[model samples]
Target: MPAEKISSLDDPRVYKFTLQKDKELARDQEIIVDSPKVVLRMMDAGRTPKAILANQKFLDDHGQRFEGMDCQVYWADVPLLEKIVGHRLHHGVIALAERPESLKLSALGHRLLVLNGVNKAENVGTIVRTCDALGVDSLLVDERTLSPFIRRAIRVSMGSIFRIKVRTSADLFSDLQTLRTSGYQVLGTGIAPDTHRFDKIDFAKKCALIIGSEGFGMDSALVGLCDAVIKIPMRDHVDSLNASVAAGILLQRLGAI
Candidate 1:
């Protein structure tokens, strides 16, 4: 069905779809995509939008993208749309898309990323984008990791989240141990006595690269469980790199295989 044009900001449908105050309200069932570029990417990735809110101008210019899409496109003035969404609608567009199914560790490839305590949404999104660009097989995040589906994370990733295979683990440590037993050399990003130089890692075998949180590095328990702790050679007394930056470097190197 074509989008039902709506002019009122108070429409119950608009209220239900534009749950800005509670970003995670229906996260399990639906995701909100702001900006036309992201929305278009979502559609191109075969994701169907449940509803779309945009100004008539936006519809006039970009509605063709949703030409045959079976979804409602609510039209409102720019000001009204802004008022309803609690922020300036990027390009006067926002979409409600059904969330994709979670991936399984058993279904992923040999090269995978394991995120331990990384909780920053932007970092998570950046890492996802990096993983996509570097050709990392999949992402395995622990319970404490932020959801990449969050609006800010999605925006930061520039729509790459939809392209990556992401799986969540209830017990990250146990999963890492399991990966070790599965022939994956679980390598944690850290500085330890046995920490190998980043460039020296052998990418021939299957491996899981572990990235930890920003404030605190990997917990000792996780560091201890690693087949090896890898470190990027730095100078000028730099102690560490941003989690996302470190992941990008590691992904680029390890994913080369």
Candidate 2:
């Protein structure tokens, strides 16, 4: 499809493309992917966008990918595009898509990373990329977790979120219990009297690892529910690591990378 030109910011089709508070966008069910590279990655992941608003350069380079795609395409000058999105168009492209229906919890892949209370978008993004790199099959975000589709997260994730199976779990505790009943071990990251050294944990089989929030650790109830609690053995002076850094280290061990 030829790219439609977006001249007016007031154009109804471009409303969703315009910039808004992250809170508002997070509440919406749509995923807005920016950057030509990330947009292509999303398409390669088999995500058909509802619409695309981009510049001519993006079209010139990759329009063929949309040959038979059933979606609206639009383009505008860089300045006008920036005005619409309330930001500089470093990548000169953006795509709006509806969140795809998630798979059932029982249907998720063998290895999973469950976000318990981790709420930072950047951490979630980095974890998304880490999961993509380390072979974690899916990401399960609990109710306390923030939306992974936030623009910052999508940018930080480098489009890995589009490729990964992610689900915002309504009931993570019960879900984990269900997974455990199905022969999958549920692992939580934290340091407790009974917690095992992360490197010593056997991750050879099906497992779901839970990452807690940055400030507080995992919820006590969730911690009690874990098949085992594991922790990164660090120097005595250091109390804890950044959420993303800890997740990366754990994931490296999780996938044996």
Candidate 3:
């Protein structure tokens, strides 16, 4: 039997060499790139030598020609890297690659999840992760929401944020109107008495579930724009779940339906 070839980052064929600022290299080097490239570097804080070596070995064996360029490797201590990136949690490994394009609402095949005023990056990341898990077609981020690509959100989502389609709308209300015109049933989440139980809704129909901020529920005008208002039944003193948690639950139920 022939020895199978192993791809390595060191292979000149595996990567494209480029000059990047040392600061940008640490924050999210992998995601910043335009191609399928991984950035390997040493972090200043709590440097994990074992992880770094492991990453190097893996990159050497499996990395594709990084757009026919060289892989960049940088060295920095914990304090300097943190100062450069404006945050501390690099986990000793970061890579930037081309992310899948955000899916347009018109191109979506089934149900959608729309986020409004959900500014917390972690929550946004969680919702995206859930969307991927529940087989939701796409995610819509209103202009007021946080960026799902932020490092913290990406970390919290375990990179699932990259797997799902994310689109932003400057005028969310107008976007909802467009969805309605396209025959999507816009379902808004809230606690009002008139809201329908989540289980009662028919998820088989092309639908869009709207989740509002943790502090404020959906905007009144947006709620009125939805085809229906839905709520998850809860017990104990729980009035509501976190935006991400609620979204996950709703998506799961919708998926089951």
Candidate 4:
């Protein structure tokens, strides 16, 4: 369809583009993405937008992309666009798309990262982007954590969000058991002296690295479930590393990708 010019704040057609909390959007399995780059990356992942709102000038410069896609494309002046989105105007375009379907544990590769109640969006995003770069096959996140589809997380992932496979586990313990029985070594991150140092072990071909909440480390149950617990060797002065940084280090060492 041709670009529909948005003229007024009262326009019903552009209503979905109006802002809402990311949590609210996630409740409906929907996400509002900023900029043409993110939208383009999302499309490249074999997904289509439900609608796109672009500044008129932005559309003029890059209109070819919207030519035949199956979605609404609306352009408006900066002032009106700001009002519609309830924010300062920037980034030429924004798109609304549903979250990609979640994958099953059985469908993922041998190298996986399991997030147990990780609370920060930035941490999640950084870990995801690092996972994409290092060839970590997929991510398994427990439901207690923030959704990776949250807007802040999406922004931080820098388009890697669209490229990674993620599975949400309702029963993380049971799922870990299944993975362990399938010849996978479940590794836990911990600070205990007896925990195997990351460099000391021969990392398994099929391994799941479990990272727990930042404030509270892995709870007792999860630690007990793991076949082995591992720790990064660091100076005694530095107690712990940021979750994302640690993830990058471990994944690079694992070379499972």
Candidate 5:
């Protein structure tokens, strides 16, 4: 039987038609093309369809195909994306995607990092990258933390955001109690004169590192709840480091490097 042709974008039958390898190759190679929506995954070095759409002439010619559907054109190359997103790297495509739902804290365990009130998307992204690099078991984001999958976060993380398990919390203190009950040691970061160095903390035991925001630092209530509060020693007038930078330092101190 001859395969049916798709006549309309809205037809449910249209999804059933699979593009053959040759056809897919042809589509990928075509200089000007259109789709209902173009999903970009990374903005690395490459000739992307997104790049074409940024051009007025090319968009004028091919933009009609993407008409009526949500459209985003990446006129700026990788450097421009980096500047706009506040991160240094983008893997050539930025995917237009649905936001993923958050997981529950009850569903997590093992080595975990809790982000408290860290609002900078780039910081969130960098921590995610460190977590993945260190093989940390999971990530928990309090209400104040930025979404790990946001464009700047994704770009900064170099896609490591997808590799880590993430959960959200309305009350991080309550969540800390749950982790404590589950035999997880909750450690908070601080730089008071009496605090222990992060390297002295035993990470071989089940643990969670509570990282605070870039500006205000962790809440005192949360700090008091920790099994221990630790800090990384520094030189000069550096009173502190960026939350993400501190996270990487702590991870390395814990032998995660």
Candidate 6:
């Protein structure tokens, strides 16, 4: 399609489409991907783009990527694009892409991450990127966990979210038990009386590492049912670590990557 020109940021369709809430993205099946790498990654993952909004420089440099795609390409001068997105552009590229369909728990792989109450999108994004890099098979998100498809999450993940299977479990407790029945050793990450050092755990078995929110940590009931609790031995006065950072350390040790 020929490139189109966006004349105004106040265009109703632009606001309606761009201002979607994180939760709405899954229902609407649409996402806004920023940066050239993330946009190109989304296309490579076989997700279709609804449209692409870029500055003239990007259009001139990379516009050929969209040559035969069934989507609109809108290019504007720098200032105009900044006005529309309400911020300085990131690598002068933004794309409106369709969200991938969610997978079921049965469809997820052997090694998994079951996020319990991990609500920060940025942290979730970092974890997703780590999982993709470390070869953690899939992600099973609880109801309270943030959606990995949000703009900030997708950007931070660098499109790694699209590379892994993601399934949302409506009931966190029940799903954890179900996984145990399915031959997965459910391990929760935390500091407790019974917490085992990272290397002490046998990672050779099928495992599902459960990560909790930064502030409150995992719920007591969920922690009690874990086959074993794992912790990273940190020095100094640090009692805890960021959810994503802790996940990366654990994944590196357990992921065998």
Tens digits of per-residue lDDT, candidate 4, 1-257, equal 89989999999998777856776677778888877677788888888888889997778877787778798888899999989988875787888888777898898788888888888999998988888888886899999878888877887887788888889999999999999889898899988889999888777889899988877877678887888899999999987888888888998976553
- lDDT tens digits, residue span 1-257, model 5: 11122233343432211221223423343212222122222212121332221323334454454454443443344344334333443223222333345678766657789898999878988888888788785898887787675545765776666567788788889989988988888888888887788767676467888898878888888877788899888885998998888998887654352
What are the per-residue Cα lDDT tens digits for candidate 3 across 1-257?
11123233343322221223323434433333211122221111111211121134334553342323433433244454334334452443344443344556677655788888998978987887788778885788887787676555666665566556677788889989988888888899999778899888776477888999999988888977887899999985889899998998899976654
Which has the higher TM-score value, candidate number 1 or candidate number 4? 4
Of 5 and 6, the candidate ranking higher by lDDT: 6
Q: Rank order by TM-score, top first? A: 2, 4, 6, 1, 3, 5
In angstroms, the error of model 6 at 182 is 1.2
lDDT of 3 at 171: 82
Q: Over all chains combined, what TM-score does candidate 6 have?
A: 0.93
lDDT of each: 0.81, 0.85, 0.62, 0.84, 0.62, 0.83
- Candidate 6 residues lying further than 4 Å off, grouped into runs, are 23-26
Weakest 10 consecutive residues of candidate 3 by summed lDDT: 42-51
Better of 2 and 5 by TM-score: 2
Model 3 lDDT, full chain set = 0.62
Name the Cα RMSD for model 5: 11.7
TM-score of 4: 0.93
lDDT of 5: 0.62
lDDT digits (tens) for residues 51-168 of candidate 1: 8988887788888877876888788877888888887776778888787767767877788988888988889989988988888868888888887787778878888888777888
Winner of 3 and 4 under lDDT: 4
lDDT of 6: 0.83
Clash count per candidate? 2, 0, 22, 0, 10, 0
Extract clashing residue pairs from model 5: 40-94, 40-95, 42-91, 42-92, 42-93, 43-91, 43-92, 43-93, 44-91, 44-92
Q: Write the per-residue lDDT of candidate 6 for residues 73-140, one digit (tens) a residue.
A: 88777887887877888689888877776787788888888888898888999999999999886999
